[model samples]
Target: MSRITLELAKKMIENAEKEANQIGVPMVICVVDEGGNFIACHRMDDAFLVSVDIAQNKAWTAAAMKMSTADLARVAGPGQELYGINTTNNGRIVVFGGGIPLRKIGQIAGAVGVSGGSVEQDVQVAQAAVKIFEDFE
Candidate 1:
């Protein structure tokens, strides 16, 4: 499986940043490989510092789990298993909105994440980025 290209990562971050700015939300966007390793990250000037980890975790969760962070949150629930996972990951894995799997030809290629905004706003930015991959010809 081919890794996500740097050009694609740049485009994803640029598009997500633009969308976040248009919506009046500063954000940190991150992209990761299928193995959940960082490909690239960008933080808007006004984005919160905490957004860095949030964005990274979001991407990591999506790549590691092969599912959207939002979906994982829904299924993980508040329980022993979820708690264990959190502990196992040492806080690297996050179940939240803002993270989405990146697919190419219907296979997961990587993931994108956005942070430093409300969950809905983050989701919107990440969704837009993911859509770019999905709609790529």
Candidate 2:
């Protein structure tokens, strides 16, 4: 499948939620298509309300930029090539961890984002979602 299906999005969220629970952090998980359109989102119990928008923005940033936000963060730092990029795109771009593109056959299919935790925890959850995507048949 070239695009993210609802089934895959839901699976990604499920895997992310499982990771969040294991990490003992409530999270807001989001999935988006290649065009940066929302596919699915989940707010765990006790998750920060503000994470709702952040999670989706992370997903959008990943899909639109076609790279993980963690990688983007490196180039987006002060005096870097993409410095101030977050200020552009109407402030929708996130320059940190927890946003990852889902690739199928070396093509970007969609993305997953997780928030409401520390950067490490969020990245763990997003990585879990990517694991599901990679393991899909």
- Candidate number of the best TM-score: 2
lDDT of 2 by residue, 46-122 (tens): 99999999999999999899999999999999999999999998999999999999888888888998899998889
**Predictions in order: lDDT:** 0.86, 0.92
TM-scores for every predicted model? 0.91, 0.97
Candidate no. 1 TM-score = 0.91
lDDT at 47, model 1: 94
Number of the top lDDT candidate: 2
> In model 1, what is the error at residue 22, expressed in angstroms?
1.3
Q: In candidate 1, what are the lDDT values of residues 1-137, reduced to their tens digit?
A: 44688888888888888899899998999999888889999999989999999999999899888899888888677763564465557878787788998876677899998999888999999987877666565
- Tell me model 1's lDDT, rounded to 2 decimals: 0.86
* Prediction RMSDs, each to the true structure: 1.7, 0.9
Off by over 4 Å in 1: 79-84
State the lDDT at 41 in candidate 1: 96
Clashes of 2: 0
